[model samples]
Target chain A: MIQGNKKKFNVREIREQFPALRQLIYGKNLIYFDNGATSQKPQMVLDAINLYYSKDNANIHRGVHYMSQQATNGYEDSRRTIQNYLNAEKSEEIIFTKGTTDGINLVAFSYGQLLSAGDEILITAMEHHSNIVPWQMLCERKGCVLKVAPINKKGELIMEAFDALLSKKTKLVAVTHISNALGTINPVKELAKKAHAVGAKILVDGAQSIQHTKIDVQDMNCDFFVFSSHKVFGPTGVGVLYGKEALLEKMPPYQGGGDMILKVTFERTTYNELPYKFEAGTPHIAGVICLAKAIEFLSSYDMEAIQKHEIELAEYAQDMLTTFEGVHIIGEAKKKTSVVSFTVDGLHPFDIGTLLDKQGIAVRTGHHCTQPLMDFYKIPGTIRASFAFYNTKEEIDFFISAVEKSINMLR
Target chain B: MTLEEKQQEIIQDFAIFDDWMEKYEYIIELGKELPIIQADKKTEDRLIIGCQSQVWLDSSLENGKMQFYADSDAIITKGIIGLLIRVLNNETPEDIAKVDLHFIREIGLQEHLSITRSNGLVSMIKKIKMSALMAV
Candidate 1:
């Protein structure tokens, strides 16, 4: 459904599409600023979820019944939608999994099989634990060496250090396109070029970048890209892994199950073709179909406008936060998305967070699953307010006042 | 006051507040007034396991009565700890172990009591009970 006035981007109209945005929390209008964790679903996606389970529910890929075929078509069409979104050359390269963590593990377990001892995997200091732990586990299992590139105090990757770390021994360079805890957008395209120069393949963890920017795997020349549907206004339990066709064909199947087998015999077993080789059980069918609706919902708006709006919100919040006496902004990268993390002198993040909760403003406060980054900053945790496109300056205004009140109460 | 009487008194104090603001303001004040734990008692063994804030709780049995002291990095958690100690301090070990902390829920601060809340108050309460049981 076209929202009908595409000429000018109207955030209010876009906000209307999300039912969760129109509600009350503790008698105040809910000001949700936790988008970096997950996004609220548009009504279209919610409706699609209900429609799929109510009408078209069936096991996909092997049944000859009408419902099964319809379910299969919806699931495949969703793959094509994601393929077009990421500009992958073929739909066969899109492998659906549980989410970003699952996608990274698939590469670690399957692609790790091809690596021999003494091979190296290079990652950055700012990667989320999901990206770091998989490589460590792979190293433990395969005897590959794990190397980390340093980031400056500003939370930006030190290109000199990254360059020094990349060598011929490096077989894989796994990094996040954007930092979840710091809102730092890494130079993935440049990093990809450098990795290729060293004869190493790069995997871009797009968990934070997919919703905020345009992604073209071919344009970026990344060997692998992964993102979660829930972070892009879709349902949870579904994710996409976009790998180069040649690389995917070379890697062994991730999981062996009913759908991932071409034929099984007592003597020998052959794996199914490209995409199916990775998808094991009956997948999250309703979630996949609803994710397509989410992508469609996102496609209706101007992504550039959304990106601009989100950046404006973050900048506005950061500038307001800076005016306060003891508020210290954590990440001040040259290019950042919709995240403002900070610490206050003589105040704990958990205290501030609890005070904000009483006032009906939702923000995340903790280590944010980046303990190494927290330790680098020499702080326990931070109070983070991450915005989405549907948010407005009005919500930021309320959030700022809430923060002030919370600080006063905390002090 | 008896333990049940102390709980009733706290409930009455909270009932006077019209909204969450007034209640939180009082809690923050209580948190600010919470006594600091002795430096020597802040050992790793006394640290609670599940809270987002680091909470150290120490207890002793003096003359068959329970004596509890606690501290936290967060003021709100400190205030909540103040409430817990107010009711349980100086009670008998059997009473400390057997008493239901209904006052937490009665005062509309039940979120902290939830098992999913990582603030470690639940763990602190459990530890207090385990200590009380040991003393018994």
Candidate 2:
């Protein structure tokens, strides 16, 4: 376990957990700033994956043998672990998915397929394509109207516009809890309340939010919450979709297959229980097991303390970036995550990203899959450096120095 | 064109970046290589909606092959478009469809591409491929 002292979250110790962090890029220690895309997995998560495949590999649930029981136990145990992590009402509410994209698609297909024409689905101006496209597809297919709530010039959500958009016709409200492109921490609780006031169910895309904040679906009053495990230092190909039991039971099964059914019949078939109904075929067993390990790793740390450390790093980065002559920071909302999106004058973002890569700093450059938001902002893209709990202030200094050098070189 | 011929052409053009610091000069040089679209052809139809630079791409099929002509108002973007055209232009629809382009990593270009530029490149590729498929 990492020590709780202020300096105990050493970059060396944190980097040690992620073997990839030691890798040399341009003969320098890799400073990964692309955590917004996907986080690097720790050795513990890797070991969990290896252990599962090496020892406990078997078909889960149906088999009566020892290996089967072990596999089943590992899989179900992960569900319980995640349920506790999210403070979900029950393990049945935790449905394993491929990732945030799959989770959103599942809800859109299941809950969305049920909506009639003239119903409205409200999403915000700043949503990842995964959140926006699925709902758009749903509205397009179901003859429902898709309405967007606007945002301010600062990339903050316009609450009044959101309020005006909400009506009794609004069947479902799907919005991102955190803007992956802008790093804005949205008022999802307020959005949820607004949706529920109009008798509309809400789904919070928690992919970016879950990493930086502690989430309680009950407290937020969101009907569904979706997040990818990869964004939270867990293995790729695994995610969680937490739906209220009543909502899960009410909606149709997302996909048809073996595990999702109660019984096989030539005439008629009934779907299985809450989670299994959404989980079709053989799921990502190893990834799910490792996700539990990641959740365990996060639970060990004091979340408030970690958040404080990250905020400090973010503020330092913001200050350092402001010193650069041509640098412009995007997304200056009062509430934000540890993402800093900036554009340097005269240097294209791609050029900046390339030069940064040479300096062993990995930052995401471009629109970040938020083309609509980019269109709204009227910029091609910004070089984005999103921080994780494991990042350090020294790394930020190195990053700022690199940016300064890069800007100078480009100039 | 044969793969060898394409390689030769790219190698010949690669010297244009000998002085990387003179980016504006290289960008202007890249702009010169870009084939011009007719003034009447300039329309909202040709404008790539997401780019900060005013980029216009137009395509035509000849002898069952797709050909692309693109220009960008921003100089470096023009160079990027030229880079893209070097890789993608004149390929068969089937060949273009199978090209993984993970080789962008080999040439060390992906690291240089911002996610948006990467996405724009992807969107451009997708559009080009769609046009090729239409031609086919």
Best by DockQ: 1
TM-score of each: 0.97, 0.83
| Candidate 1 runs further than 4 Å off | A1-7, B49-51
Error in Å for residue A370 of model 1: 0.4
Among all windows of ten consecutive residues in candidate 2 chain A, which has the lowest summed lDDT? Answer: A1-10
What tens-digit string does per-residue lDDT give for candidate 1 at A1-411?
344643357888889989998988888899999898999999999889889988999999999999999999999999999999899999999999999999999999999999999999999989889999999999999999999999999999999999999999999999999999999999999999999999999999999998999899999999999999999999999999999999999999988888999999999999999899999889999988888888888877778888999999999999999899999999989988899999999999988988788888888898888888998999989999999888999999999999999888787
Give me candidate 2's TM-score against the actual structure: 0.83
Per-residue alpha-carbon lDDT of candidate 1 for residues B4-105, written as tens digits (9 for 90 to 100): 999999999999999998998998899999875888998999988553688899999999999999998888888999999999999999999899989999
Q: For model 2, how does the per-residue alpha-carbon lDDT over A1-411 read when each residue is reduced to its tens digit?
A: 446533344546666788888788867779989999989988899899889889999999799999999989999999999998888999999999999999999999999878999999999999899988998899889999999999998889999998999999999999999999888999888888889999999999999988899998889989999999999999988999999999898999988997999988899998898889888899998889889999887777777877888888888999999987878888999999899998877666866676677688999987888989988978778899999987888889899988887676555
Determine the TM-score of chain B of model 1: 0.96
Task: Name the lDDT of candidate 2.
Answer: 0.82
The alpha-carbon RMSD values of the candidates against the true structure, listed in the order shown, are 1.6, 5.3
